[model samples]
Target: MKRENLLVLLAGICTGLAALALTMLGNPANMGFCIACFERDIAGAVGLHSAAKVQYVRPEIIGLVLGSAVTALIAGEWKARSGSSPALRFVLGAFAMIGALAFLGCPLRMVIRLGGGDLNAVVGLIGFALGIFIGTRFVRRGFTLQRSYPARRTDGAVLPIIMLGLLVLFVAAPAIFRLSTEGPGSKHAPFFLALAIALVIGALAQRSRLCMVGGLRDTMMFGDAHLLWGFAAIFVTVLVGNLILHKFSLGFGAQPVAHSSHLWNLLGMTLCGWACVLLGGCPLRQLILAGEGNGDCAVTVLGMIVGAALAHNFALAGNPDSVNEAGELVVGGISMAGKIAVLLGLAVVLAVSVFNSRLGAKKNG
Candidate 1:
């Protein structure tokens, strides 16, 4: 195999092993590596959301940022840059969170779910693929967030600093930052182990550019299956690992941390997939870029944090059986508020895709 293929394969193996380790050691089932879910929990930990059951500053998340930063710096790949439309990316980040929470996972987690034999994630995977496909249409039409520019080195180190601060807070047992008393927030692998695994996974991912959205998009658009190899590795490794460990169980019902609303799973991920493609990267990519000093990506990360807080406050998130703010929006076993949120997201994504497109700029010129 070529060197690039080897690196991506290594990255995928690292992702699967890390995810499986976290789960086996006590992280939530089918959720050893969900950026959105972890962010929502972090929001709760910081009192951004008062959802007490989900409050905890995840060490893995902090590790991801710092680890990526260290790796990029070591590899001489670190670059501080920004300039893409910050506000639009922020809103898109929020909507992306809304959609992920509705689906109960992000693209990575969707794959993880599939590896664990949750068929519902199959529905979600379809939706996510469709969303990326739609976003490709926008890409073909010249959708652009504009160019990024160089920035100070300090900008690149911000995420690592913040992550270190959070770690310090955790150590000091600060009352200011809420630590969970129970629920998913309370369950965790050994902190040091989780951190180490995240560091390894983040470093590898940074180097390999492991992105599910890019993987699918490239395959669909360019017939290039290079990115797919990483995903395939992740799936195959996790599937085999789960089977060997007796963690594999086929079916939609009784899947841990997952709901049975198949359509919502599909639609929610669709919104997420479409938004990620238009944003120029997935949530994982955003985090990695932020570590390398991309201010725009950092802004998008902040948007996701805020979106997580808002999702819980507005009763837009879902649990094992139902979504919050249950009412007329519920249809096809999915909430109506959820439905409208997705529709609005689609409109915003479409609007951005068209209006900010290079085609529009050319027309004006």
Candidate 2:
């Protein structure tokens, strides 16, 4: 393999190891790092969710954005710009988190879930791929965001600094933030250890542009599995790590903070998959891209924070025991309504994009 490919492979291994170690240390199984879940916890810390059992200011997320920023600054990759369909990207981010929560994990969690023997993750992965395929179709049809212009350095760096501030606060005031009483937040690696792992993963992910959603999308659309190779490495490494840590629990009868509803696992990830496609990357990808001064992604991250708070305030978030009042099993409930809303919203946005693109083409002609 080429040197660049080799770097990506190593990076993927580190990603898996970091996640596995987090789980082995006490995080929910296969849930070492979930973008949506962590954001939800953060939301609760700031009073977004009153769910006392699931509240904490997560430092990993803060490290992700700030770590990427540091990489970009050192590499001279930071460039502030916006106007890439900002509102649309925001909507996509919100929906992506919603979908991820429904499945109880992000793409990273999906693979880790698989490693830990959660068969439902297989369905979620498939659904995620299908969602990406749908988004790819739109891309083929000329789906594109608007161009972005350069902005001030502060405009780009502000969010990262803010994230860093949050991290400092977390380290100083874990009690005020409200660590989980009985959930994933309660079970954690030591503060410095978790921070170190997150920092390493964040730096590597920043360099590799490794996104779980983007990996499969690249393969299906461009016939390039370079990104997928990273994931493959992650899977193998994490599986081995799980074995060594005795975290390998075969057959998922009742996994921690996970549900057994296969259909929801599939559908939720489908929505998340599609949203990631539309937004141009997954949650992790958005953070990395934002660090590189992609203002559009920055806006999307803001949308996710907002959406997470909304999810909990509105009783949309699930508990650590995998019990969501709005789960797929709840017919004629809020979850169903949320699903319908997401589908219709996406359809409307897509139709508008198509119509606007055609009109612009005609005018130019």
Best by lDDT: 1
Pairs in clash, predicted candidate 2 = none
What overall lDDT, based on C-alpha atoms, would model 2 receive against the true structure? 0.75
Strongest candidate by TM-score:
1
Question: Per-residue CA lDDT of candidate 1, range 54-173, in tens?
Answer: 888888888888888889989998898877788989999998888888888888888888999988889989999999999998787777787788877777566777888888988788
For each candidate, what TM-score against the reference? Answer: 0.94, 0.90
Each model's total of backbone clashes: 4, 0
Q: Which ten residues in a row have the lowest lDDT in candidate 2?
A: 328-337
The Cα error of candidate 2 at residue 143, in Å, is 0.5
Per-residue lDDT for 327 in model 2?
A: 57
Q: Any runs in candidate 2 off by more than 4 Å, and if so which? A: 172-176, 318-365
Query: Over the stretch 1-365, how does candidate 2's per-residue lDDT look in tens digits?
Result: 97667877988898888888787676666778887888777877877667776677776787688778888778887788777788877877777777777777788888888877777778888889988898777666666665678988777766687777777777677566656777566666676777777877888888888888778888889998888878888888888888887877865446666766666677778888887887778888888888778778888988887777776665654333333466524221236655564465457545645764565455556
